[model samples]
Target: MNKLSDEKPNTSGVLSAAARDARMTFGDKAKDQLKEAIEIVNATAKGLGISVGSTATAMLDIHSVAFGSGSISLHDETGIPLRGMGTGSKRLLTAGLHKEASKSKSIALIDEIETGLEPHRIVRFLKSLGSKDAEPTMQVFATSHSPIALQELSFNQVFIVRHDKPGGKTSVLAAPSDAQGALRATSSSFLAKSVLVCEGKTEIGFVRGIDLFRVEVRDKESVDAAGVSLLDCDGGSETRPFERAASFQALGYRVAVFIDNDRPIPEAEATAFVERGGALFHWAEGQSIEDAIICSATGSIVLAILEAAERLNPDDFDLLDSKIKSASGGKLNFEDAKSFAEMDCLSSEQKAWIAKAAGGKKGWFKDIGRMEALAREVVGPRFEDFDEPFKKVLKSIIMWATR
Candidate 1:
């Protein structure tokens, strides 16, 4: 079977039928192939538990494997194209299968788990290695050069495969037990996505909050619950963060560096560094992630509520005005303040008016933990969650900014 498989394979990049036919392959066919791949991997690696299953292909346009000029994609059973899957989603599914097999005391194995994934998505893949719901009681092993994957997996879990120089024998090198040491050594080896450089705990706190609010976020529940590892590369200056990002990028992450706009280096220079060397995503102009939240009544919270109300009901500017007056201290325009001062500037009547217009008490400031929450309710019921809904807004912003 191996010989036949190798013989039939196209060695060169002549664009094999698999790539061309991938677009036409239906879900059932893809599922069978995936299942076969998983089974074969399982057979090769004993002890480590592995399982496989199929998910109903949702949107296939993203997954179609195209050959000619345009790209092709895989399709589902319905002849609909297969959709693209993220590293996180794929890992989740993979972990789920392994979990099920573990429940049945089955052996686990996976050949190439990094297929069809984005670099940013590797964090998710590494996180799934330690899933709590369906953990591999035995062992888990995979072959991947993805730095994100390496960084995300436990040091103990890492095994470097190499050929014995003299004997021509295959050998494996276990990563150092000391995590910091292993990470330091590996940082020089991989290409990281983005390095988040922050001032201190506060900066770390802010970045972490922002990450949570991100639409395509690393799954904290799975990562933390299952003991999946993540690198918290925190530092004060661009020097360390930049250094770490470079090191990790060399090892292989689409590295982005996150730093406060108020850091020592000029904002322009810092931004330029990030743009040129590292990919950095920061808070909206003059606004930090902390400002994203709206308090219930005091401070910037009301301003946030007012902003949401205004955006959703742009036609009712007068209504917004009245609410601003009611909430303001001296009937000031709620939009005047650059920050939360707008809330204090208004009177109670304006506050109540704006809140009432938004959907009454339950309408405006219903949830106050994050500003994204307020932004969503104002936008529409469709955007209930802050991250999912806010991501669309961010994408639009990115497009606009680039243009």
Candidate 2:
């Protein structure tokens, strides 16, 4: 593999003796070729989302020819030197120069290709790397940590680097291209060995919270150490979970679906997922994550969560009583409130209201940042107070991830 790094662009030495000869002889063909080369560089830079001044020029001076004065200097749109341009622009210009100089049968390796580039520019840069009509076919291997770069790549072009913890062996696994279209928003998950497809943001927070707690208090490894990534699937959509799970499964990566019990996976899909060696983790039937947490967690843990919520959003809590009364038509104590909300007697609206109150924007469990802190400080030390089913869920996730 030929590595093409974005080192300092040496414009002076690039002016060859042949060009000086052509200039001295006043040969039309060589001058035309030089002009064509300059045009190609400018065009390629434009395609890579770089703005270059039209004043960019390469002139051969007869008097200073022996001193290597026949050189090219690039400028930005405002006629400023390329050296004075932003890093992203300079990198793009350097890339353009490399592409112009490349042969037909070339394999280019670029490290951190997305560095100093804006997210939107990443797509254009990728497109410019491919072979176009009349251009030589080339292969490009680029490394990037940008999600935008991942989104622009087809799954077949993507590989997840898996490092075995015990053996310290690293392997690269290719992702299938079938899910490329649907994965634009969730492409970052492809980097991990195993993915936990969460139903929504709240579920993401809870899982991350638990992970933080374990790492800080229990002196355990973080989820990242287990090669697990959590993806929020924007909840309540029945097909999204299955689609995402299938995407990862096609890539030969271990995947687990973590959804609310209230959202059931169709039997056929569930069976197919299991048949294909995927794992599924969900709450108890008829319960969302909030319900499960409330019903299963120890009373002290529940009180702590509530008290923490109150502390975080005092004004929101002040309005909670009136809102609860309007939704439930009666005042209920915190101990019985969640259970009552979970019962079959409540209407859909009432259930939604309860859900909002439990995990909405201003709800106790809604702030992922605070939840992370809580997990580290409070939940981590008292993790045993979490209900058995919740504990089982955590264990299952860890087991699946490590395996």
- Top TM-score hit: 2
lDDT of 1 by residue, 1-403 (tens): 4454435545445444444445445333645656664443334222222122232331224333443433423333354432333444545555644554554445456566566666654554444454222445545567775665666666667665656679989866565554434364444233222233332333343333333443234232321222212334533454555555544444333345544332353456456556655555444343323333221245355555556655645576765555545555444554563243453664444434343434322233322332234433432222233344234434443332222
Residue 158 lDDT in candidate 1: 65
TM-score of each: 0.29, 0.70
Q: How do the residues 52-170 of candidate 2 rate in per-residue lDDT, one tens digit apiece?
A: 75534344443345544343344444535566678777777776666667666567788888887888766666666662325545678888888888877776677766778999898
In lDDT terms, which candidate is top? Answer: 2
